[model samples]
Target chain A: MALALDGVSVEVTGATLVRELSLTVESGEVLGLVGPNGSGKSTALRCVYRALRPTTGAVLLDGTDLTALSLRDSARSVAAVAQDNHTELDFTVAEVVALGRFPHHQGGGALSEHDRLLCQEAMRRTDITHLADRGVLSLSGGERQRVLIARALAQQPRVLVLDEPTNHLDVRHQLELLSFVRHCGLTALVALHDLNLAAATCDRLAVLCGGTLVAIGPPADVLTPELVQRVFGVRPTVVTHPHTGVPQLLYTLTGENNP
Target chain B: MTLTKTTADHPPARPTRTGLALPVLALSLTLVVSVVAGVALGPTVVPLPDTLRYLGAALTGGTIGADEVSSYSVIWQVRAPRVLLAAVVGAGLSAIGVAVQAMVRNALADPFILGVSSGASVGASAVVSFGLFAGLGVYALSAAAFLGALAASALVYLVARNRTGVAPLRLVLVGVALAHGFQALMSVIVFFAPFGEAARSVLFWLLGSLGSATWGALPIAGAAVVVAVVVLVRSSWSLDVLAMGDETAASLGVDAEALRRTLFLLTAVVTGALVAVSGAVGFVGLVIPHLVRILAGAGHRGVLTIAPLAGAIFLVWVDLAARSLFAPRELPLGVITALIGVPVFVTLLRRRAYLFGGR
Candidate 1:
């Protein structure tokens, strides 16, 4: 599937959060959106997830305009794990995972055997099958975040959108979650604050600055030290992985004699 | 099956002692005892067996006793429906209270806080003042109140809902504004209508009464409660996810928007039906749900079943107080519920940490 934001612009209260931005994620490819705070990175993803409508432009999934699809149909097509994961109700992990089948099940209808298997498969993929019966209210932040991702995975959507999914996760789970996303046979759009993690997991990188697509290409081409300095306002040493050949930037605070 | 976990997610184990058997048994026993006491303590007291005999006659479809005529008539026809109406209204209010509080994720929210009761009152007052159903003369006031209740909540929902979703905070804010508007309009009507019929009718409604219960009102209250209970029980699973907030619910594909709207309307209709039959009985909806939440955990399965039972039992006695606290007359049911529920609620509030929502 081809995912494209064609000339996307988002405005809230007469102010533009993201403007005239466009990018694409090919089938089975992972595209990373990286930018500093307030740069429209999350806003652009929000437009794609149908959380916020665009002021102008449109999102297309496999050549079909996303707007043309009903919200439920689009929901079945794309699943989201957003940063706002706070919940007031206490549901067991298995119950939470089972909710991913809601788009398919109507009133008084139980999940089919196939749906149950999918829920278990998704939970196992997230390494959360052990916590299946645990109350979500009692889980730590990192564990709950994984559960959210697992819930999205259970949706079995062709495309997955994650906005800062790793925000509350620990270092190890963060790496594991991203690497797992990369290995999953699905198109993924991810917003990340960590440049190194983005470079490592992303097949292609799109740098967002001031609500616009400043640069889009492979990590090597788009994440130069100069680009990092220009967009993130931080001086970073650029290096390549010893075996994988992916460009990774290591950041450091510049001091009096640093330049 | 036991939940497998080396590490407890929430180390502080939830107090799960609040279960079905005890609370239900307690409620059933309370209803029996309360109803009996209510019959025994009313004006022109009858013996216990006589009371039972009269009730049994009603149950077994036997002839009405002569000595038990005024006493039995007063107990069954005049007073029993009134008491049952209290229980019915209380059950509906408390159930709606639990649902709405869970829906909006607010602890302080009661069913009527959404303008349902006052809206009913306004409608009741309008019908009385204008004589809408004087020709039909059957259910003029109640029909008006039910319609009014539905219209007010629907209006509040429409005003609050936006493209993003109907956030609980927005819904409550809109509800408060709309309720004030309804009450203001009601006040103006009260000022104009005559004190004997129109204005006095509105006053009785404001105080909330089971005193007005008639055989006519029974079916409406029964249908509403039955529908509310069925719809809520069927959707108990969703209520758990809903408490988690919209983002998580949508992510799970629970159709968060649709669920919110559906539950909101359900609660409104339930409230309208209760208000129509029993007037504006308050405090039960606000109190019983919290009590159940504390005991049974916030799971909707336990809450829906337990809150209604608790409310129904509690109101049976509260209505008894309304009837027997002064001889030969009855106080408003709302006053008794507030008096009983408020103290119990405060005490319960002090008992636990009382946090709401998923961590």
Candidate 2:
């Protein structure tokens, strides 16, 4: 499914958090939304997942307005790993993952064999199969993140919205997670802070600054030194990776900002 | 990776279906035994055989000997209704406790946290002290309390909601604030009562009693509790989804706002019906759900199923102790629950492995 945000704006408590943001992710493409802190990246992603309705305009899935569909219908196509994904209860990892099939079932019925298989496959793919019976509250941060991703995968959604999904991951897991999202072959809109990782994994990058889209294109065109310095307030030395040929940014502490 | 290492070090011990079944079965059986003991062992202790004979005669409409008339009357007319009411109110409180905790997503939340009990208190106080709802005669207090409960819940819902919906924090804060206000209102009503006995009786009602339990009061509270249990058990999965936060619930196609509204109304009505019949019984709603959760994990279906039976058994014994411990001068039901609940809850909290909602 292709997700399109058409002239979407979100204003909360007299402040425009997201301003007329229009963008589209082609079917099965990974679109990275990158911005500095408080640049409305999360707000835009919230709109796609229907966590926050746009003050104006609409979000469309496959050219049909999201509001036109029932909540269950929309959820069948879209799943989210939101930034505020935390549970106070001590649910086992398998139990939490099985909750993804709630929209598929009715009235607290037992999970069918098909639903069980999907949950098992999701846990296996995320390498958290060993932790299936472990209480989620006891797991490490990285393990918990994988469990959440597995839950979203079990939902079997065509469109996935993830906000800061790589926050608590180690370096290797971060790369692995991004790679998994890349090849998962879903229309994913991921809000990320690491421009370098976004450049490496995402097929296209969309940059936001002060609640508006500053640029959207291939990583080579969008992650230029001037744009990085202007948006992120840092000096970067951009270079191609030796093996992958993706742009990587390097910085030094003793730069022009020194007093 | 550390993830793999941690998993290997602590091998998973999956909780099987039989694990839940055994505890549920045990609790159900305990409830039955407790009900029998409740009816038999009161201030006027009837012998076990006579109690059984009375119960069987009443159920089968069989004739009893002339000498056993008073014993049969005591068992059938007085203790039977009181014991059944305790079971119904206990089941309702425990079930609604699970709902309220999940609805607000706070481990400390109880059925009365939404101010319904305090609201009911104000109404009961008005009737006891000021003679409100006088025309209703036998039912005046209950009628007034139910109305007060509904009014207070509506106020809380209105105050806590915004354009988005009722945030859990806002609901808790609003409920606590309004609860205090209602408590003060009840105090004022009690303070201005003309006679000393009126004040004393009002205090008894506030602390709670099942002394007034009769066959007439059973159907309303029993029906409300049954409906609530069925609805809550059906929504168990959604409650789990809702407890994860509104964003996650919305993403999963469970309308968090709509579900919250429904839960608020359902819990409010059920709590009102219960408080109207049994007064403001405490501790069962706050403590039973947590006990069940610790024993049965945090799944709502298991918690809802087992907590009611556990609560029914616990309250049956509590009511027995309430009537017979002081003998001729009955202690309040709330007093016994708190006396027992405080020590048990504190001990549970002191355990190294038990956190309120987590390990």
Q: Give the per-residue lDDT of model 2 (tens digit) for A59-125.
A: 9998999988777778888999999876788877898998889878756898899999999999999
- Counting clashing residue pairs in each candidate, in order, gives 8, 0
How far in Å is the alpha carbon of B239 misplaced in model 1? Answer: 4.0
> Model 2 — interface RMS deviation?
2.2
The two-chain DockQ for each candidate, comma-separated, is 0.35, 0.61
Off by more than 4 A, model 2: A254-259, B1-14, B17-21, B357-359
> Can you write out model 2's per-residue Cα lDDT over B1-359, one digit (the tens) per residue?
36544435343554644546778778888888899999999989999999999999999988999998998988999999999999999999999999999999998899999999999999999999889999999899999999999999999999998977899989999999999999999889889987767778978887889998888999999999999999998899999899778998888888898999999999999999999999989989989998887667778888888988888888999999999989899899999999998898778766534444445
Ten residues in a row with the worst lDDT in model 2 chain A? A250-259
Q: Residue A115 of candidate 2: its Cα lDDT?
A: 98
Error of 1 at B58 (Å): 3.4
True contacts kept of each: 0.36, 0.67
Clash pairs for candidate 1: A87-B358, A88-B357, A88-B358, A89-B243, A138-B9, A138-B10, B94-B285, B208-B280
